[model samples]
Each structure stands twice: as structure tokens, then as C-alpha cells.
Target: MNSSRHYVIDFDSTFTQVEALDVLGEISLENQPDKDERLQELKSLTDRGMGGELALRESLSLRLDLLKANKNHLAPLIDVLKGKISTSFVRNEAFFEENSDHIYIVSNGFKEFIVPIVKELGIKEENVFANTFVFDDEGKIIGFDKENVLSSNNGKVEQLKALDLKGDVYVIGDGYTDYEIKAAGLANKFYAFTENIERDKVTEKADHITPSLDEFLYVHKMNKAISYPKNRIKVLLLENVHPDALQIMKNEGYNVSLQTGAMDEDELAEQIKDVSVLGIRSKTQLTKKVLDNANRLIAVGAFCIGTNQIDLEECLKKGIAVFNAPYSNTRSVVELAIGEIILLMRNLPDKIAKMHEGNWDKSASHSYEVRGKKLGIVGYGNIGAQLSVMAESIGFDVYYYDLVEKLALGNATKCNSLKELLQTVDIVSLHVDGRKENKNLIGEKQFKEMKDGVIFLNLSRGHVVDIEALKNNINSGKVNGAGIDVFPSEPKTNKENFESSLKGLPNVILTPHIGGSTEEAQENIGNFVPGKIIEYINTGSTTNSVNFPNLQLPILENAHRLIHIHHNKPGIIAHINRVLAANDINIVGQHLKTNETIGYVITDIDKAYNIEVVKELKEIKDTIKFRILY
Candidate 1:
């Protein structure tokens, strides 16, 4: 051992966002007859253990005994735990890796779970001083090892003292035992790590309270400070964003508030005032007046592919960067389109509906095979293109039409116009972008031209098609079956009554815009867009931005970076340098870019400058926003 300063981090609620035993009970006793009761009991046991209200062994033994689990649940439990790690830890893997020799996990959580997750961070097995599980001959969990130090009260302190550890030791945790480490002089300082949960008894006596790993790293100056306290930067994620996206923003240290569904413009406007980062799906509309209320909004993350819901021009004028995951959910949407096509062709909807109603009508009147049928795809974009390749691979003839020419994938052919595509194919699926010009692009005239009994699917914008015309076609048997994912207007919440023209119509599949609702797709989008937003926040990057001028700058190590956004007028760069020169803060290097409306500049300066320099930059004319980053 190097005999240097050490950091003993907690496992549950501190290093990870959830208590291990609680999650374990949820998974292990998932199908048990007393699931709810056992879960509550396990939670109580965890509370008592962390509060130091009971001997650690008693709590561990009791909770473990209540577990009806065997060794089989460990693998899947670890997978779930992998995603639940504290956001700070996920973002700062390098810090833990580089300082693995000095960092340790001291907790009453089981080694079976904790060891596997933290080991991925380069923490050694021997250094992890957590309780170990004892299993019976049948692999059922019996209890924990009675001799493990963490099984006893004040185990972390006892273990650290036994190690005869040298130098300053900091115990970063969220439980009473973590504080006891310092109370016993086993550690120099106790930092109450509360990225997940906070306990008052432990927090009251802590030398420092850290909400995130980045906060701790920032306070020690071991790492450069981010733009702001992540927790202080308010993020309003609307329209039921995936928990993963919310988790990512939380990981970056942003204060995040979530609304499970979309809100109306007035309610959204009311919620926009204090938000710095606003994330929404396709439904929440951000009008000019709504943008006006977002006084502190710096970025908007369109969690879906389309940005039509937001006021892009207004966001640009406000120096706010807008980002979207145009390709992240493409496969998901395409797969849904393919599945809907197959269902429609096989008359599966009617068959399933009749089956549900106890009607045994197994006739092959409307049913047909998708193979050897021509699938006309409108707007050959990400989803349409992917669907083309997959459809052709499964023996369907593919034809696509777009305003702009796109290279045909596989044996798929491109039609010159939407008319030719409609006249020729057996089925037509729309996948166009939701720009204003695309509104009513398909109406009665387009429907009139399609062959009778032609299947139709619209996975794009609701306004792109005239719903009344679609209902007419289905009524006249001009279209055999229709699958409509998007609607011109949808209810703000799940409890609201739905009103649609095609409701209760025969062979019609009217869905609530769930084209990309798969677990994999949401997870991908949740990971993709927030990373871009955080990139723009931390490194002044706008690589995938929709509104702002595109620019990306790497981290300026051991230096302060000045980010200035201004109106795209002449002499801004010169004015900025003049201000820097007057303040005697030499600019080591700078990067500048401009578009039609704004100028963005990233200047690295000597870290020795004071607040006056920052004040002068903010006072400059036409400065939309000025931030000092370290």
C-alpha cells in the first residue's frame, strides 16, 4: 500500500441511487404470496440498519431470512443494479479508476451484489469491506457471514481501524455508520453522500454534504468545476420521458423535475420560468410566448426525432441550443411499422378482436401474405429507409417516394412522386418529417388515387393526413385496413377521453402515438439526447444542435473557459478581447463561430482572474449569455 489518503464510499443510497436490499427484495420476492408485505418489511430492516437503530447483523439476518431468493436471481439483479448506479459515479468512472488504490466501499450491503458492480470501476475485491452472504446446500440465501466486520454495528469504523490505515481517510456515505467512522477518529472527515437519499441523523454531523460525485471532486479541486451546481440547474422533462434520460441528467448533477405526461401550452408556460434545461417529446408545444417565459433556459432536448413541437427560431434568438435524437429510435419506429403491416395483411386485428368477443370466424377473406406485395414508403428518411431494407429482406417488394432523391437500399425502388407510389403499391406507409409544409400533404385527393383495398399506415405526424378522408376511405372499403399512430390532437394525460374521427371504425388501428415505445428505443433515446445536452452544458458543444450555431470545443485542462453568446453582429470578438485586455486576463486561446443570428465564442483564460472579469463580460452589449467554466 502507498499509505496515502483513502476514501471509503458507501454502497447503497450513496454510491448507488437505491438501497440494495430493497431492490433485492423486489426482485427475489417478486412472485411470493406476501410480496408487498415482505418488501415493506425488508425496507424497514434497511431503514433500521442505515439509521444505526439496530445491530447491523440483526437487520441483515432478518432481511436475508425474509428473502425467498436463491443464487439464480443474482445475475438479473446485478443487471438491474448496473443501471441504478448513482449518476455521479457513472459520469466519473475515470476518477474512480485512477484512484482505485485509495478508494474503497465500506458498507453493510452484500458483497454478492456490491462487489460485482463496483469491480467494474476498478475497485479491488479485498478492498471492498461489505457483508458477505451465506447460502445453504440448496443455494437458497440463509444469512450473512457472522464474522464479517460490516455485520456488526460501527463495522466500517472497526474495519478501518483494524486495517491500521495511514493518512487522511474520508468516509463518503449516507448512513450513520459512515459518520461513526469519523466519530471514532478512523477517518479525517465524513462527507454525507446524498445523490440518492438523505438521512438527517447522518447528515447533521457530516463535515461536508455532497449531493454528487462531481460535487465532491469539484470541492476538492481534484477536478475542474462544471458550469454550475448540477442540482441548481433546473430541468423540466415533460411528456413522460424515459427514466434513463432523467437519470442521465441527474447523473450530471442537474436538479431534475419530471411530469409523466405532456402539458398544455399554458401549464407548460407556467412551468418554464425557472428551468435551465427543458426536455419534451412531440406533444408539448413551445410557442414564442412560452419561450419568453423561460428566462434561464439554455438548452432544449427534444427526446424524440422531431423538433417541430418547439419554436426553433425563438430558441435560436434566445441563444438556447436545441437537440434531438433523429436516429436513435429509428429502428423502433421501423419495427413497429413492419409489425403493423404484417398484422394488417394477415387480418390479425379483426381475428384477435373477434376472438376476444368469443366469435370463432376463421375465414381467409381479407387476409393476405405480405410477401410478394409492394410496400410504398413515403418520405425515405431514417425509419422509412430501415423499413425498406427489412421489408425487402422478408420477400416484400419495396418502393419509396421522397421530395428529395435518396439512394435506394437493397432491391427497393424509388418512385418519382407520391402519386405514382400511391397508384402502384398494395400498401402505403407514411414516414415524413413534421414540418409545417407537411401539414395536410395527404388528403382526399391522395386517398382518391389509391387502389381499392390498399392497406394504409401512418407512423408520422397526425396533421400530415386528413383524418376525415382516411375514415371515408375505410368506410367505402377503398382501404382494407389502416394503422394510424399519430393524431392531430392527443389527450394531455392517460385519463383524458380520446376523440378521433376514425374511432370504432372497422379494420382501423388507431393508436395513441406509441410508434417508438419499446424499452430498447426509449433507453437509447434517453441515453443519446441528454448526453448531447450535457455536452453543450459542460464543453460548449453544439454538434447535434438544431437551433444554435454548431460548435464543439474540447476541455481546456487546468484553465478557465469563458463561453460568450452574442448577437451575430460585427466587432463582437474584438469587443470581447478588449474587455479581457482591460481586465489583464490574458486569453490563452479562443474559438469563435457564427451563424445568421448569433455568435458563439469559447475563450480559455488564466485561472487567476477574479469576479470583476466575469462581470465586465456579462455587461457587454448584445451578450445573450456569458458563462465562466472551469
Candidate 2:
């Protein structure tokens, strides 16, 4: 291994906490209000998985056209970068000072923006290789240099080749161009720097993946080793999660303590003191103070779908990564919805209650079969759509209403409005998301518009429906019966007992938010969610992250799996794979997947891997961590 291997890194999310270019564009167009529309388009393009280069090109051109931002605007933007350097970057300045000669900033982003940030980081200007932004006579940002290789396709690879360094070259970035460096054989190694963004394709091809820069420095053996005291990571596992989840975390070498009951904020804080990782279902209240006292905390695991129990913004500011099981439990929730809908339509709960009370009321008048009945669904996301197909298979007509357009399955009808669906269907099931707008969505007005004696169900967010109004409707014979699972104010910890407003109501079924509480769902979650949490902790792989970047990679064969989870950006995978190819390590199989906030990639190598490769992988910028997974 060459001691002088040049490390080329990308800017934007790869080096910084956020996308500097995107932020610049947003700032440049702040005054032009109409430019906000274009900014949003750029955001969507990036959000929809467009690589950073393309998003930057499209967004930059639009912003420049709108603001004509020049040197003056650049100053404030530079201030933004200087103000918000990634925390890891600020903490590891000695690593940069020591390895300044081997480091290079190779970015397609404008040097005008990159220069100031590099200067602030104390990197010499000569060490930076990026595109230069050309300003016009009015000091306004006008155009870019088309001739610059960094501005073109596979430009970073081309630029590295142009550098003509004798030793190995490694690329670290969060964009497609960074990944291209390895494909072009320009760099010896690529580290998918996922601290900022983890793209699926990029991670699939990389030799190593990391979620934080600290992991990079540690893996590379580039920083001074100080004997720091180990911070104990105590984890709290809550209800609705399979017991195996805690077992798996324990298997993964975590210090886990299980508590079965629920606790308020003060009690939870006391219990979680000296804890680093907190795990919960829908029942845990990860309040602001809870997070504040959880100073040792690095990550959070919401064992269920919704993260409303946790404060997301506080977690982000506190640099805590929150993981949730978005799809692992989808089938469980959907199956329950199908079963509950059928039960409600057939008055099964009502019949069962009567049987429990020793009243054998075998009357067929109120008990109707689910077949041929219309099922109205609110929110056609994963759970709702799956339920639609299952309901249709059972000989029921499905009608769905969603704010956004959704693809219908089977003979499902897409209602133009919620009211229209409410008026037309016999069974109304709620599967809407846990957004703020969904609170009190199904209230008195909507209930009054529903068909009399219509059966109602809510397996989604508890706040989505007005439970008080639902109870009234059920009692008044307007709604024949109801099934309530999720609640607005749910107990935070699992051990805490619950009392519902609709408790003991006639003809109503009350479940403890167990719509996804099937044995299979629990097992799947037990296997997958905790696996993701452990992977993120061990290797920074965010394969199933609900709020992070999306990286989807193909399964690999013989290679030692290297899982990387980073912020979703661009060239991270290219950097990782480039490192492997440079070391002559062949990739056998790979798997990559991502969400809105994290990118996860699993790579397989063909032969026994070296620590050097992992070390080099960690050196890439924006890396969270890299680990060997057997």
C-alpha cells in the first residue's frame, strides 16, 4: 500500500452537513419569490433521486438566471458554509492538517463556493481541483466554464487522471461523478462517503461505505489515537417489538437492557441515563429533555412505522440518527386492515362481544357479509394499496382517496374527494400518514356526510380521526361499529397501561395499535429493523432507513460485505469501488437500498479482504463508518 495515496473528495453533502450548492441556490432566489418554484423543482429533482451534479447544474442555472447572484452573494453563502461545517469535520482538524499534502477537493461544484470553504478548513488553494464559476461585468453570476473537465460527465475521474499522480488515487463524494472515477480507472479506491448522502448505485460499486467522517479517519488510521474513555451505550427496547430485536442487538455487541413497561418523560430519562441507543415502538415519548439528557446517544430506533413519538428536528440538531421499520411491518398492518374490515362488515366484533357475554344473538339482520360490500380507504401508500389488492381478492369493491395521486390495484376506484368516498362506501378504513395536517381529518362534518350505519375503522394515525366524534357516531347508530387501533395520545413506554376514550363502548373493537402486530410482522421487524439499527451502528449501513438517503445495490457473491449508510447525495459508491478496483479486489455481489434520509449498500468481495482496504475506505469524506460484515 502506498503511503502517499491522493484522496480526492467532493463537496456539497459529502464534505459539509448540507448541500452547499443547493443552499446557495435557495438563498440566491429568496428575494425572487417566483424563483422559489424553480428552487422547488430542483429540490424535487434531487429528492426524486437525481444525482447531485445534474441537480446542481439545473438548480445553479435557474438560480443564476433568477438572481444574477455574483461575488456579493457568494460572501454570505460562504458564511453559511463556514457556519455549518459538519461537526465531525470541525472536530478532526488535526487529521486535515497532518494529511494536507495527500488531500484534494475534487468537485464539480463552483470553485467560487468551494474555495472559501476550503480556506476555512485551512486547506491550501493549490490542493483544490474543481469547476470555476465565471461572473459577469455587473458582479453577477452568469455562466460556468464548459471546457473544464470537472464541469462535464465523468469529469472528476478525468480531472484525477489529469493530475497524473504516480501513487494510488482515491475519490470520496456523494454524487455519480465521484463513483465514475472508479469505473474510469482513474482512482485506486472509492469510499462511499455517506455522512452526507448515500446513493444506491454508488454504494453498490464502492469498496467501502461510511456514514460519518470520524469513521473514515478511524478506519484509515490517519488520526492520532487518544485513549478516550468508552461511552456506555445503554438501549431501551419497548413494546410491540419482538423480543428478538433486543436479542439481535445483544448479538451485535451492544449493551442492551430490556424494560417491558411504559414510563413518562422523567421516568424514561432516569431509566435511559448513561444510555446511548434508545429503541421503542409507538409507545415511547422521546421528548426534548429526554434527548437533551441522552448526551451519549448516537442513534434512535423507532421499532414501528411512525416517528411522531420522537422529536425529529431535535434529533437532527443533536446529530442523532433515527431508524424506523417502514416496510418490514407493512404486510402486518395491511393484513390487519383486511381482517378488521371484514370483521367490521360482518359484525364479527359485535357477535364476539355478545358471545363473551353469554348472549347468543344469532340474528342475521345486523350481521352482514363482507363480500359485495364497498371498502373505502384513506391514504393509498404501501399499507393501503396492499390492503386494496387483498380486499379485492376477497370479492370486495375498494375505493381509495389520497391527497397525492396513487396507482390503484385490482378493481379499486380512486375517489375524487374524501367526502365522496365517505358518502359512497360501506366500510371506511383509515391508513393516512402521521403528518400534522392529518390531525382531526375525519371529524364531525365528514361523519355527518357518511352513510348511516356505515362501519368505520382507524388503523393509521390515532389523530387522523376524531375519536370523540367516532364514539358518538357509533353510539347514535350513524356508524354501526368501529375498530380503533392507534390513538392520538398513546403511552410512550410499553409498560405503561392505557385507557382509551372509546373503551367499553358497545360494538367497538379497541386494539393496542397492533394493526401490524401479527407474529410474522413481529418476526420480520425483529429480524430486519434491529438488523438495520445494528448495521448503521457497526458499518453505517442505512438499508431500511425511513428518513435518510436511498441506496439500492444488487446482492454480491464472494466478497466480504461492506455496508455503508450515509446521507443521500452522489458519488460515494464510486469512491468506494474505485478503492477496491485500485487494490485489485474484485466485487462479487452487492445490495443497496435507500429512503429519504439515508443510503444503505452491502457489497461482497471475491477474496479475503485486507484491513488496508477498509482503512482507505474510511478516509473518504462524508463517511459515517465502515465495518467488515461476515
Candidate 3:
């Protein structure tokens, strides 16, 4: 509550999430036949005014004429605005109530609707200066007061000049009129509020562009609901994960930077020095060297299913939580495997190529239907199990083999060994994970056991299948046709060329690891992985984290929570408790969990503790990281 500075805030698209006049048109023109067209025109006028393309006076005149709104529409518009408050503003309602004396709502809108919205926020009615609506004898609106300063162009600058005070002034808004006050040298600074809308023209003239009200409070070092502002946390997203994911992280107020392709270890090390959250798909490799350079890295979001590309051991030691979408894209990979099985069995790739070459032999030489063919699924996990059910539904007798015991789905049989399943089936589809032992799981010895003319598929990890062995088997006619999505090695980006020994084979179907590359799967992964990353960052709840021990924490209420990560050794918790005891800090609650390598502890204490307690906690021996949550 800086008493030396007066705060002037905007109304439409700043305090509320929408333009008040645009919404007023919707309420008043609900039953009109051309309601949509009128709404479009109203929105255009609002944008033009906010963007400085039209004067505020003219924009308001045209919009009011089109709205035809009367006194009857103001109440409903007020009610709609109550529900449309900006999310950032709604969370910081206390800030407005505490600083009611110095805060003012100055806008080009009418006081009829603005008063009701700001009244609940503890804003004094006299402090709220805006245009007053003039009503007719029958309560139908005619026009605004012509003498009101807010009804004219550059009205905010004129209005602020008339209310001359002896303190520094600051303006926060989304419209060009808000910046006009500062341009005239009436205010010390102007902040372009982009929580709901960002006018480029206004932002270019602003001293600072705040993504939300929280950002404004954070920069001023005011007491806010969050212990730290999200805008300060640097997030780097690479490998072109999904637009939905990028938008979600940006809306969360993270300082996000995106790169469309993967980066090598040295390149990533240089870029990851200050990044708090790192996002990637399958291409980028998070090795020990890369993780060592990430001094501020707290979490890594793998947008794809596998975590083999990331170094889990180093992540655990460094107190970095890793999250991956394990099941969101399972159905996508299963569908691809089923489709590939049918395509390779019917020999459709060869026939399609022949047709494209202008040759129409039209003979069923080696084609076969998948109705009675035997289907063997290797490594029956989430994708493999769903594939088993789908393959069985299409009339194939399914068999699966895994090192770990898994229940058979439908009427599918479980094989005792890889040898038994390989020798027994007409088609072998690999669906294993990316563990080191699974590399080259299907090689020369395993392929020799498969039935001759068998249709084969590998939609799993690239290193799981030996490509040369499969090519040799195809040449020997032991395997008639094969489908492979993953490869032994892939280029870092789509711009690079792909070379493989399986290329130019007669009936081979070679795809560039597109088993789970569907739009739907990417969207689901986009929704899932970022949520986990945000959860871990905000509440220290590593419920779905792969490297950290699972901990699901409740929301903090009326207290400050201290999160401490350290090595899993004796007397770690005792040392933490001793530090709190010596500081005379009263503990509300405590939680502790540990894996083989690291320990995580959360301590909730009363807010009255001195700030020096945080310094004492970090000085504990073997402490990896410490943070405070409110």
C-alpha cells in the first residue's frame, strides 16, 4: 500500500475479461435478427479505439448508437461482468480492499455499470471518475453528458490533470487512452496490462508490459498471494512439442521461449543455465553434461511417452523432477500398429507403388487377409495391451511375451518365452519400452525363429530392433513384408534426411517414428505433461514425477510451507528439525519421503517466523535446494 503513489486502473479488458460496451450490445440485442453482425461491428469499434485507430469519443459514439442500450440493460451487464473478472485480479482481491484510499477506477465507460462492479472491491464511489449516462423520461438511454471530461478525446489525460495531487501517479490499463496520461507527463510510469488483451500500439509506448496484475505487484515488491510471480520463472520449450502446450505455459505467466527443433548436449548446456522448466519431445537428449549446467532447472517435461532420453539418475541427484506422458498417446501407437499390420499383410505398399509407376498387374500373388493370422505382441505394456485387444477384435489370434508377468487380455494367450512367441506367430509386433536391456531385443537370433513369410512390425523404441537383421530376413524371404516406425538412429529435426538399410526393400513400410504422431495424441500429451510440471512447480507435489519420489501435497492455507531436498542419508530430517528448533519457529505440519538416492521434506510453519530462518535452512549439510510456498 504505497501511499506516496496513486494507482489509476482501467475497467474494460483490464479489471474485467471483456469490453463492457461489447457485452452490453449482446444483452440489449439478444432477440435482434442481426445480433451477430452488430456484435462484430461493436467489437471492431472497441479494438479500433483501444488500438488508437479511432478517437475514444467517436468510438464510444458509434458503439452506443449501435448498442441502443437502455437503463434496463445495465443491471444484467453488471452481473455478467462480476463473473468475468480477470483471473489474476480475482486472486488478489485483498490488494484492492487494503489500498482503497489510493486506488481509482478511471475509464471511458459509464458510471451506471462501473460503480456496481467496483463497489464490491471496496473502491469509493467518489474516487471512481467516469462518464455518466443520460436517461430519457421513460428510462430509455439517449446519450452521455456532453460536459463530462471522459466523453472527449484524450479524456483520461484531461481528467487526471484536473485532479492535481502532490504524489507520484501510476496508470495501468489495456487501452491507448491509459498510456495518454503518461505520454502527457502526468504520471511517473504506465503499465500495459495484457492479462486479458494486449494492444501492440499501447504496449510499445508503455514503460513495462505486465502479463497480469500479479506481475505488477511482484515488480513493486508488494505482498501478493503467490510467494513468487510466475513471470519470473524462465521456461524453455523445444522440439516443437505442441502449440496448445506453449499457450498453456504462457497463460500461466511463465517467461516462455520456444525452439522448434532439438539441441545437442553442448548447445543445450549453454541455453539451460538459467531456465527453470525445460520441455522437450523425443529428439532432445538430457544427458549428465546437460543437466550439470542447469543451475536453475527445477523440472523437465517430456512431451512424449519415453524418459529414456533424459538422465534420471542425475535428475534425482540434482533435485530436478521429471514428468512424462506415459499413457496419453498409447491409443495412437496402437492404432498405427493395427493399421500397419493390415497394410503389410495385404502388401498394399507394393501395390500402391506399382499403381503410381503406371503398372496395373492386378494379381493376388502374396496378399493375405488378417482375419486368421497369428499376431504376437512383444513387451505388453499400455500400448501393447490395447493393441492386443484391438488386434483380437479384428479376428486375429493374439499371443504376447514379456519378461515381467502380465495378465492376458481377451482370449489372447501368454507365451513362456520370446522363442515360443516368435516361432508360433504369423506376425510379430514389438511394443517394448526404452530400457537399456531392451536394445536389440529383436536381432538375428530372434528373427531366425519367426515363421517364413511373416509380417513384422516394430513401433517401439528405435534401438529395440536390429534394422540390418530385419533387412537380411526380408531379402531371404523369411519375412515377406515388414513395417517399422522407429529406427536405430534418427535426425534431430525434420529438415535432415533419413537413411536406413531397410530403404528400397520390395514390401517394406518405413515410417519416421510416427506411431504416436497423431494430432489427438499430441494434444492429449500437451494437456497432461504441462499440468504435472505446473503442479510440481507451484505446490511441490511430485505426484506423477518420474525421478522424484511421489508426494501429493494439499494446497497451503494460512501458513508458509518450506520445501527441502537433500541426499537420502541418516539424520537429514533431524538436522532440519534442529534448525527450526533453534530459530524458535513453530511448525504447523511436516511431511517427509525418500527414495534410494534422495530425500524430500516439506515443513509448514507459522508466517510470523523471521526471514533469517530461510537462510539457516539452506545452510544445512548436503541440502540440494530449498524453497518457500505460501
- Taking all chains together, each candidate's TM-score versus the true structure is 0.71, 0.53, 0.93
Worst 10 residues of 2 by lDDT: 224-233
**Model 3 steric clash pairs:** none
Per-residue alpha-carbon lDDT of model 1 for 298-348, expressed as tens digits? 999999998888889889888899999989899988888898999999888
The C-alpha local distance difference test score for the whole of candidate 2 amounts to 0.74
lDDT per residue (tens digit) for residues 400-498 in model 2: 999998888888999999999999999998888887888999999999999999988899988888888888888899998888888888766555679
lDDT of each: 0.87, 0.74, 0.90
lDDT of 3 by residue, 129-205 (tens): 99988888878777889899999898998899888855988899999999999999999999999988888899999
Query: Which of the two, 1 or 2, has more TM-score?
Result: 1
Greater TM-score among 2 and 3 belongs to: 3
For all predictions, the C-alpha RMSD in Å is 9.3, 21.9, 2.4
lDDT for position 241 in model 2: 61
Question: Candidate 1's C-alpha lDDT?
Answer: 0.87
Give the top-scoring candidate (TM-score): 3
* Decreasing lDDT order of the candidates: 3, 1, 2
Off by over 4 Å in 2: 1-233, 491-497, 551-630
